[model samples]
Target: MASLQGKVISITGAASGIGLATARLAGERGARLALGDIQAEPLQKVVGELKAQGIDVIGTVLNITSNEDVDNWIAATIKHFGRLDGAANIAGVTTKEAKYPHLAEVSNEEWEFVMSINTTGMFYLLRAQLRLMLPGASIVNASSGTGLFGRPGMAPYSASKHAVIGLTKTAAKEYGPKGIRVNAIAPGPIKTPMLARVYGETKEESKPNEESKPKEDLKPMSTIPLARFGESPEVATLVAFLLSDDSSYITGTTRATVTGLLGPPRFWQPASSRKSTYGYLPAGQELEGEAGSPRLGLTPAQKLAAAEARRLSQAQKRAQGQLHRAGIEAQKQERLRKKRVA
Candidate 1:
């Protein structure tokens, strides 16, 4: 087992989804946790469970979107944990895609609210964290696959996620020399409460294959290449890795979980290579899963391999171009020699 023993990890949005799942799993691994959430009841529930399982944890009710709240949250972490070694900024929100209301119709209040929680909020928390972060600490910011590739009608969400990538890279560069690693996770469609809000929150409810429903043709699953959504643990596993030493060599990159939607390489044959993929896994398998059951797109080795491949490909392409040009010139010289002989 990877020993997270004695590590002081702080996570925002500890109430649910990836945040809550991360806290639970990290606790099981023996990490001391400073967990924060807006929802006090649920957050306390998590704390209760962790304590029951003999995990060391401290719970705080924090709103990451607020600057003062963010400041206090960090203060509390350092006061309680003595030093901060890891943090995961995983709080976010989502809403349904609507048509009658053009994006321009979105109120500034709404826009700011979304950005406050998704982008600005994370920035505020991260800045506060970097102050107390020890050398070799890690930070992870949450981006989204929707931001990686535009999703129609989610303008606010896309904007926040894109900015998240910018923040992650900037921090990675700034802290790399200091031994702190920063990275971003661009999660695809996960079956969080958020997804239910985004894709299933319309008044246009439907029956399962019953036909005669007006919006029956508007099933969003058809577009998701894997035909299902991911669970919170799918994102949490990657979160844990980024926080752990397993990914010490990895930084400055935005990793994603395109669970139902495969990568660019599998864009065409979504079904062919995808057979090897466990597209979000079925409920039966998930319920009966053992330790480390979920595998996000790339295993740790595959992630390293892909990174090496990208580096090699760039170098190979450059050399190939140079050699090809030299070969063309040599061929021209041979033709000139033959003509002179003629």
Candidate 2:
């Protein structure tokens, strides 16, 4: 194992996905952890588990969009761990609502939300970490494959991630002389909860073949050169390496962890298939009525409602899945206990 003995690493979005994986690996490699996430229950659960295993850890609920939250998290880390050695700025969000939409169709609200979190939130993380980082400390920010290239309907997300690279590089130069290393990892098609949200949530993944679109071509696996979604641990290992002494000489560079996919694939296949009855109608604009066409296009209000319904549905499914997994875990523990008694 690559040892991180005596190193104290702070991670954002640490309750789940990439952050959770990195925390586990960091524990295995002998590092103390300061984990921050927006999800309180999960954050506490993860921290409790790590503590059970004797891993030094402290977790807090953090809203990365707030400068105050970021600042306090960093302060709490230093207070708990005594000093900070490294950080993984891994908190971010994705979107499917803006998929395949024209740039003009994107709303100011949507644009601002994505940028505020993915871009500005990262800046907050870097700022706070750099303030207290001792010499030789490392910082790894999470960018995306889309950050490297543009994708249709993903303007806001792509732009935000791209900004992450710029921030990473700039900070690397600023801090290199002081012995701090800053870098980014552009991961492609990682099988994360965030990816699930982008691709219509966890329930969509489990739907029968008959229920899903039959003609859908070029799935995420097919788009990637490796023909598979990258696992969380795979990316975590890379993050650990970047945050460890092994990559001490590396800085100011963004590494692509994509499975040989150079850029985004053509998400929209058939040109005719791209056509929809509900076109991109700007807010406050009336929908065009086609008397000859059997249906009038959906109004802007209706479209927003549909999108909200999908979001809520996805959330419900995700919650159910979590509960199901918890039940399974309880059962497994009971079985183990009975075996021990026997």
Candidate 3:
């Protein structure tokens, strides 16, 4: 692990998912942290948990879309830590609708809402961080795989993420001379709250119920070479590396943690042209057997193993769904109790 000892790092969206994962990992690697989020209760809860683990940390509740909020949070971080060595701009949101609407159907309000947080808010945070950061400081911004390629019915989101890449590259070129580095990470189908929401899964469930299947056409896992969702900690590890000296030579590039989903061969080929056995192979072009016949499908043992893996995965998701429901109920009860006391 790349050590972040004594480094003072600031992170946005630190209340949950990838942001929360990064905060925990950075703290464990000995970094002093300033965490900001729109949710005060969850942010404080996370800060308290980290503090108990002996991590040097502070929490601030602020809307990233507000310039004043973004500026004040950065200023407060510098005041608390004395200096900022690194930052992870991880705050972002998707379209409000459960099903993404076509560009023609999307209203101005929806477009502005996504752009305000994902693009303009990022600009505000980056400007403030750059003003205070010294040479050798590093910053990592969150982009998305959609940023690289257009997704149907996600015009606003795709445009905003593309803007993220544009800003990251521009910042890197301008700041590289001063010894500062800027980069972006484009993640695909990470197992986070955002993904859950995108899949139409409610807070009470990890997977969509039979009646409420996801509105999107793509089956996310089936398209990916990894055949599973990327985990939060996996992306956090990359962010940590970018923040540390380990990635000093790397800047201005958008690194993808997409599990080969965006690899040239897979991405360029049409779905109908591809087949998956042990790996992705062009249709009817797999490895040949000793008799020179194409090996078209998995062996019986391999099929059994695949079946067992899927069964276990479904079981895990069910267990997670139960836990999610329990947590929500607990929160609801707590809120009611507080209301009663007041």
Q: In candidate 3, what are the lDDT values of residues 18-92, reduced to their tens digit?
A: 999999999999999999999999999999999999999999999999999999989999998899999999989
TM-score list, all predictions = 0.70, 0.73, 0.75
What is the per-residue lDDT of model 2 for residues 1-342, given as tens digits with 9 covering 90 to 100?
Answer: 567888999988888899899999998899999999999999999999999999999998989999999999999999887899999999888643424345777778878888989999999899999999989899999998878866555688889999999999999999999999999999987888776655455665432233222123223443455657889899999999999999989999999886334321122222333322112212233333332335444444545666878999999999999999999999999999999999
Q: State, as a TM-score between 0 and 1, how close model 1 is to the true structure.
A: 0.70
Selected candidate, larger TM-score, 2 vs 3: 3
The superposed Cα distance between candidate 3 and the true structure at residue 167, in angstroms, equals 0.5
Give the candidate number with the greatest TM-score: 3
Off by over 4 Å in 2: 96-100, 203-217, 262-342
Candidate number achieving the greatest lDDT relative to the actual structure: 3
Please give the distance, in angstroms, between residue 286's alpha carbon in candidate 1 and its true position after superposition: 26
Which has the higher lDDT value, candidate number 1 or candidate number 2? 2
| C-alpha lDDT values of all predictions | 0.73, 0.78, 0.82
In candidate 3 the C-alpha lDDT for residue 269 amounts to 40
lDDT for 278 in candidate 2 is 17
**Comparing candidate 1 with candidate 3, which one achieves the higher lDDT?**
3
